[model samples]
Target chain A: MAFLELDQLSAFYGKAQALHNVSLSVASGEIIAIVGANGAGKSTLLDSIMGLTRVTGQIRLEEKSLIGLSAAGIVRSGVGYAPERFNLFPYMTVRDNLLVGAYTARNNVSDNIAVVHKLFPRLQERANQETSTQSGGERQMVSLGRALMTSPRLLLVDEPTIGLAPKVCNEIAVALKRMRDELGATIVITEQNANFAMTLAERLYVLESGVVKAEGTVDELRNDERLTAAYFGH
Target chain B: MLQIIVQGLLLSGLYALIAMGFTLIFSVGRVLNLAYGAYLLIGGYIYFTVSQTLGVPKVLGLLLAAMVGCLVGLLKYRLLVKPLKGNHVAVEISTLILAVVVQAGVVFIYGDSSKILLPIVPGVTQVAGASVTYNLLAATIGSWAILFALYWFVRKTHVGRAMQAVSMDTKGAAISGVDPDRINMFTWGLSGMLGATAGVFFASYTQLSPSMWVAPLIIAVAVVIVGGIGSIIGTLIVAHIIGFMEVLAVAVIAPELRGVFTMLLIIGVLVIRPQGLFGREEL
Candidate 1:
C-alpha cells in the first residue's frame, strides 16, 4: 500500500465543485508534483487533504483514514501544510513562528527549532524581526521552517514559487530538494510553474479544471505535444 | 493635587486590570464578549457573599471570585463564543445581554441596595498630606503585579506565544499546529479571571450594586477604544490617560461631570484616530 492515498476524492466550496473523483497516491520519501493552471483545484486539493475544505472519499495515511478529522487532528497525525499565500503570523517573529509549528509537539520543540534554524540561517538572523517585515523569500523560508518544526512525515506545499523572482524560485527549489534528501520527508507540491515543478518532482500529475488529465515522469510529459498543446496552448 | 495624582494612579490600575481581559479576548478571538462585564458582577457578588456575608477570609473570597470567573469564561467559550463561530455582532449583543442577565441574577441574590465591602487590607496611609486607603493601594499593587505577570507570560512562555500567534492570525496559527479553539478557551478563562479580580477590588474601592457592572464596562470599553484594539502597551497607556483625565475632572470640574470628559475623550479619539492611540491599522 502507498504511504499516502487519496482515492476518488471529491470536494466543493459552497456548492461550487473544486475537485472531482481525484485519485492519487504517494510512496514513502517520494517527491510528487501536481502541475495545473489557475482554477484547476490545486489549492482545493491540498486544503481538502489538510481538512481546511470539506471532502468526500477516502484519504488514508498509512491505512488510517483521515476523512473526518479536523485540521488540528490532521496536523497531530503528522501532516504539515504550507499554503500558496504564505500564512505566517505577520506580527510574530520568525522564531516564534517556528515555535508555533511545534505547538502540538511541545516536548522536543527546542531541538526541532535548532534543526529548522540550521536549514535556514537567515531565519536565525531575523528570528526577532516580525514576519510581516521579512522579504518574500525570507517569509517563504519562515513558512517552510514553521512546517518543518512539526516534524511532519508528509509535507503538502502549494505554489512555493509563485510571485517569487526566478533566482529566489531556484533557491527555494534547491531547498525543497535538500529537505527531501536530508529529512527523507515525502512532499506533494502543487505548482503552476511546470518547468520548476518538473525539476523537483520524480513524477508529475497534470490537473485541468478539477480533473487529472495526465500523469507521467517529467520527460514523458515533456515529449507529449498534446499535453503541451492543452497546457500552454502552443 | 497630590490626592488627584494618587487617586488617578490607583484608579488607573483597576481600570487596566478590567480592560486587560477584554483586550485579551479581542486579540485572540477577534470578538468582543459583551458579557465580559458579567464576570465583574459575578466576581463582586461572589466575593461579597463569600467574604463579607459568610465571613470567609478576604483572600479566600478573592480566590473564589477568580475561580468563578475562570469557570464562567470556559463556559462562555464552549457554549457561546465557539457556537457563535466568530460572529462579532452576535457575540457582542449576546454578551451584553448576558451581562444584564447576570446583573439581574446578582440583584435577585444580593438585592438592589449597595453593599460596602470591608477592605482586603483595612487602614489608611497618608502620603504627601493626602490620605489613601490601604484597600486601594493593595488593589493597585495587585493589578500591577498581574499585568506584569501577564505581559511576561505572553512574551516569554510557549503557550503564550501560541496565543500571540492566534491573535495575529488564526489560520496561520492553525497551520503551525496551534489549535485556535484551545487558545480561545484559555484566553476567555484568563479574561474572566482578570475581570473578576478587578471587580472584587473595584467593588471594594466604591460599593457593590447590581448596576456597578455598567460603569466598569464603560471604563473598559473606553480604554479599549481609545487605546486601540490588540495592543498591550497601548492599553496600559490609554488606561492611564483615562484614569488621569477622570481624576483631573473630579478635582477641577465636578464629580458628576467626571464621566463627561471620558466620554469626550472617547469621542475625540474616535473622531481623530479611529484606530485608537496605539491600535494597529486593521483593528
Candidate 2:
C-alpha cells in the first residue's frame, strides 16, 4: 500500500465546493509535484490533507484514517505542512518560532533546534531577530525550518517559491531537494512555476479547475507537446 | 510623600495581579473577555460566603473562589467564546452582558450594601515612618510572587510556549501540533483563577459590593489597552503606571479625580500611539 493515500476526496469552502472527487497516493520517499495555474485547487488539496479545511472522503496515512482528526492531531501523526504564504509569526524571534514548531515534542526540542540550524545556517545567524524584519528568503527559511522541527515523514509544501526572486527560488528548491534526499522525507509540492517543478519533481500531476488533468513522470510529461501546449498556451 | 510611594507600590502589585489574568485570556484567545472582571467578583463573593459568613478556613475560601472562577471561565469559553468563534465584537458583547448578569446574580445573593472584609492578616507596621497594614503588605508580596511565577512560566515552560504560539498564530500553532482549543481552555481557566485571586485581595483592600467588579474591570481594560496585546512586560509596566498615577492623584489632587487621570491617559494613548507603548505589532 502507498504510504499516504487520498481516495475520492471532495472539499468545500462554505457553499462553494473547491475540490471534487480527487484521488492520489504517494509511496514513501517519493517526490511528487502538483502543478497548476492559479485558483486550481492546489492549495485546497494541501489544506485538506493537513485537515485545515473540512473534507468528505477517505484520507489515510500509513493506513491510519485521518477523517476525524484535528489539524494538531494530523501534525502529530507525522504530517508537516507549510502553507502558500510564509506563515511565520512576525512578532516572534526566529528561535522562538523554531521552538514553537516543536510544541508537540518537548523532549527533543534542543536536538531538533540543532538539526534545523545545521540545515539552514542563515536561520542560526538570525535566530534572535524578529521574523517581521527578515528578508523574504530568510523568512521562507524560517518557515521551512519551523516545519522541519516536527521531524515529519511526509512534508506538504504549497508554493514555496511564491513572491521570491529567481535566486531565492533556486535556494528553496535546492533546500527541498536536500531535505528529501538527506532526511528521507516524502515531499508533495504544489507549484505554478513549471520550470522549477519540472527540474526537481520525479512525478508530476497537472491540476486544472479542481480536477487532475494529467499525471506522469517528469520526462513523460516533458516529451508530450500537447501537454506543454495546454499549459503554456503554445 | 512617602505614603504616596508606598501606597503606589502596593497598589501596583495588586494591579499587576488583576491585569495578568486579563492578559492571559487576551493573549491565548485573542479576544477581550469583557466578563473577565466578573471572575474577580465571583471569587470575592464565594470567599465571603464560605470563609467570612460560614467560618470556613481562609485558604479553603480562596481555593473555592478559584474553583468557581475556573468553572465560569470554562463555561464562558465553551458556551460563549467557542460558539461565537473568532467574532471579536460578538464575544465582547456577549461577555459584557455576562458580566452584568453575574453582577446581578451577586446582588441577588448578597444584599446591595457594600461589605467591608476583615483583613486576611490583621496587623500594622511602620514603613518609612508611615503606618502600613499587613494586609496590604501581604497582598503586594503575593501579587509579586504570582507575577514572577507567571513570567517564568511563559518564558521557560513547554505548555507556556505553546500558549504563546497560539497567541501568535492559531493555524500555525495547530500545524506545529499545539492544540489551540486546549490552549484556549487552559488560558481561560488560568485567567479566571488569577482574576478570582486578585478579586479576593482587591475586596480586602477596598470593600466588596456587587458593583465592585466594574472598577477593576475598567482598570484591567485600561492596562490591556495601554500595554497592547501579548506583551507581558508591557502589561506590568502599564499596570504600575496606572497604579502610581492613581496614588499620585489621590495624594496631590482630589481623590475623586483619580480615575479621571486614568481615563485621560487611555484616551491620550489611544489618540497618539493606538497600538500601545510596547505592543509588538497589530495582530
Candidate 3:
C-alpha cells in the first residue's frame, strides 16, 4: 500500500461540492507537489486530508484510516499541516506558537523545538517577539517551524512560497529539502508557482476544479506539449 | 479620602475576580456565556447549603461548590454550546434561558427569600479608619492570589498556552495539533470554578438570593466592555476602574448613583473606542 492514499475522495463546504472523486497517493520519504490555479481545489485537497472540511472519502496514512478524525487528531496521527495563510497566533510569542504546535508531542518537545530552531534560525532570533509583528517571510518561517515541532511523518504544506521574496523562497526550499533529507519526512506541497514546485518536487500532480487532471514525474510532465501550454505556460 | 481609597482597593479586588472568570470564557470561546452568572448563583447556594445547613467545614464547602461549578460548565459545553456551535446567537440565547432556568431551580429549592451567608472568616477590623470585615479582607487577598495564579498559568503552563492559542485563533490552534474543543472545554471548566469561588466571597460580602446573579453579571459585562475583548490585563484594569468609580460615587455623590457612572462609562467607551481600552486589534 502507498504511504498516503486518497481513494475516490469527495469534499464539500456546506452544500457546495469542492473535490469530486479525487484519487492520489504518495510514497514514504518522498517530496510531491500539487500545482493549480486559485480556487482549483488545491488547498481544499490539503484541507480534506487534515479533516478541516467535510468529506466522503478514504484517506489512509500508513495503512490506518484518517477519515472522521479531527484536525488535531490527524496531526497526532503523524500528519502535520502548515496552511497557506500561515495561521500563527498573533498575540503569542513565536516560541509560544511553536510550543503550542508541540501540544500533542510533549515527550520530545525540547528536541523538536531545537530541530525547528535549527531549520529556521530566524525563528530563534525572534523567539520572544509576537508573531503579529513579524514580517511576511519571518511569519512564514514561524508557520513552517511550528508545524515541524509536531514531528509528523507526513508534512503537508499549502502555498509555502506565496508572497515571499526570491531569497526567502530559496531559504524555505532549502529548509523543506533538509526536512525530507535530514528528518526522513514525507513531504507534500501545494503551490501556484509552477517553477518553484518543479525545482523541489520529484513528482507532480495537476489539480483543476477539484479533480486530478494529470500526474507524473517532473520530467514527463514537463515534456507533455498539451500540459506545458495549458499549465506550465511554455 | 483614605476610606474611599481603602474601600476602592478592596472592592476592585473582588470585581477583578468576578470579571476574570467571565472574561476567560468570552476570550477563549469567542461566545458570550450568558449563563455564566448562573455559576455564581449555584456556587453561593451550594456553599450556603453545604457549610451553613449541612455543617460541613467552610473550606470543604467552597471546594465542593467549585467542583459542582466545573461539572456544570462541562455539561453546558457538551449539551448546550456544542450542539449550537456555529450559530453564536442561538448559543447565547440558550445560555440566557439556561440562566433563567437555573434561577427558577434555585427558587424551587431555596424559596424566594434572600439568605445571609455568614463570613467564611468571621471577624471585623479597622483598616486606616475604614471598617472592614475579615470576610471581605480574605476575599480581596484570595482574589489577588487567584489572579496572580491565573496570570502565571496562562504564561507558563502547556495547557494554559494552548488556551491562549485557541483564544487567539481556534482554527490555527487546531491545525497546530492543539485541539480547540478540548481547550474550550478546559476554559469553560476553569471559568466555572473561578466563578463559583468568587460567588462564595460575593455572597458572604452581601446576601445570597436567586436574583443576586444580575448585579454581578452587569458588573462583569461592564468590565468586559470597557476593558476590551480577550485581554486579562484590560479586564483587571477596567474592573479596578469600575470598582473605584462606584466607591467614589457612593461615598461622595449618592448611594443610588453607584452604577450610574458605570453605565455612562460603558456608553462613553462604546462611543469613543468600541474595541475597548486594551482590546486586541482585529485578528
Candidate 4:
C-alpha cells in the first residue's frame, strides 16, 4: 500500500462542490505535482488533505483514516501544508511565526528552526522583522520555512512559485529538493507553472475543473497534445 | 491640577484592567462578548457574598470570584459560542440578552438598591497635597502589576504566542498545528478572570448595583474604539487619555460633561481613522 492514499474524494465549500471523485496515491520519499489553472481545484485538494474543508470519501495516512480529523490534528499526524496565500501572521515577527509552526512538535523546535534557517537563510536575517513588512518573495520564504518548522513527514506546498521572480522560484525549488533529499520529507506541490513543476516533480497530475485529466511521469505527460499546449506552453 | 493628575492615573489603571479582557476576546476570539460586563457584575456579587455576608477572608473572596468567573467563561464558550457556530452577530445579540438576564438574576437576589463595598485596604494618604485613598492606591498598583504580567505572558510564552497566532488568522494558526478552538477557550477563561478581578476593584471604586455593568461596558467599548481593537498598549494609552479627560472635565469643567468628551473623542477617531489609532485595516 502507498504511504498516503486518497480514494474517490469529493470536497465542498458550503453546498458548492470543488472537487469530484478525485483519487491519488503517494509513496514515501517521492515528489509529486498537481498542475492546474486558477480555481481548478488544486488548492482544494490540498485543503481536503489538510482537513481544512468538508469532504466525503477516504483520506488515509499510513492506513489510518484522516477523514474526520481537524486541521491541527492532521498537522499533528505529520503533514505540513504551506498555503498559497502565505498565511504568515502579519503582525508577528518571522521568528515567532516559525515558533508557532512547531506547536505540534514542541520538543524539536530548536532543531526544526535550525533546519529551516539553513534552508532559507534570509528568514534568519529577518527573524525579528514582522511578516507584514516583508517583500513578496521573503514572505513566501517565511511560509515555506514555517511549514518546515512543523517537522512534517509529508509536506504539501500550494503554488509556491506564484507571483515570484524566477530567481526566487529557483531558490524555492532548491530548498524543496534539499528538504526531500536531506530531510527525507515526501513532497506534494500544486503549481500553475507547469515547467517549474516538471523540474522538481518525479510525476505530474494535470487537473482541469476538479478532475484529474491526465497524469504520468514528466516525460510521458509531455507527449499529450492538450497538456503540451495548455500547460507546457507549446 | 495635582489632584486631577493623581486621580486620572489611578482611574486609568482601573480602566486598563476593565478593558483588557474585552480587548482579548475581540482580538483572539473575534467575537464581541457583550456579556463581558456581566462578568464584573457576577464577580462583585460573588465577592460580596463570600467576603461580606459569609465573613470569609477578602483574598479568598477575590479568588473565589475569579474561579467562578473562569467557570462562567468556559460555560459560555461551550454552551453559547460553540452552539452558535461562530455567527458573530447572533453571539453578540445573545450575549446582550444574557447580560440582561444576569442583571435580573442579580436584582432577584440582592434587591434594587446599590451597596457600598468596604475598602480592601483602609485609610487615606495625602500625595503632593492631593488626598488619595489607600484602597484606590492599592487597586491602582494591583491593576498595573496584573497588566504588566499579562503583557509578559502574551509576549514571552508559548500559549500566548499561540493566542497571537489565532488572532491573526484562525486557519493559518490551525495549519501551524495551533488549535484555534483550544486557544479561544483558554482566552475566554483568562478574560473572565481578568474581568472578575477588575470587577472587585471597580465596585470598590464606585458602588455595586444591578446596573453597574453598563458603565464598564460603555467604557470598554470607548477604549476599544479609540485605542484600536486587540492592542494592549493602545488600550493603556487610550485608557489614560479618557481617564485624564474625564478627571479634567470633572475638576475643571462640569462633572456632568465628563462622559461627553469621551463620546466626542470616539466619534472623532471613527470619522478620522476608522481602523483606530493602532489597528490595521481589515484585509
* RMSD from true fold, candidate 3: 1.7
Q: Put down candidate 4 lDDT per residue, B140-238, tens digits, no spaces.
A: 999999999999888778888889988888888999999899999999999899998889999988889999998889888888888776788888998
Which segments of model 1 are wrong by more than 4 Å? A225-230, B281-283
Query: Between prediction 2 and prediction 4, which has the larger lDDT?
Result: 4
The per-residue C-alpha lDDT of model 2 at residue B29 equals 85
Q: How many residue pairs in model 4 have overlapping backbones? A: 0
For all candidates in order, the CA lDDT equals: 0.86, 0.87, 0.90, 0.90
lDDT of 1 by residue, B1-283 (tens): 8899989988898889989998888878888777888898889989999998899988999999999999999998899878998588888888898888888888888789998977888999986778999999999999999999999888778789888888877777787787888888999999999999999998898888899888888887888789876667777888898899999988898899888888898899899998888776211
Q: Which stretch of 10 consecutive residues in model 2 chain A shows the poorest summed lDDT?
A: A225-234
- Candidate 1 residue A39 Cα shift, in angstroms, is 1.3
TM-score, per-candidate, Cα-based: 0.97, 0.95, 0.97, 0.97
Give the per-residue lDDT digits (tens) of candidate 2, residues B153-245: 887776787888788778888888889999998889889999999999999999999999988888888988898885778878899999999
lDDT for predicted candidate 1 compared with the true structure: 0.86
Clashing residue pairs, backbone N/CA/C < 3 A, model 4: none
Deviation of model 1 at B97, angstroms:
1.3
Clashing pairs in 2: none
Q: Write the per-residue lDDT of candidate 3 for residues A1-234, one digit (tens) a residue.
A: 699999999999999999999999999999999988888799999999999999997999998999999999999999888889988899889999999898889998999999998999888888999998999899888988888888899999999999999999999999999999999999999999988999999999888778788889999887666345445444
Q: Give the DockQ-based CAPRI class for model 2.
A: medium
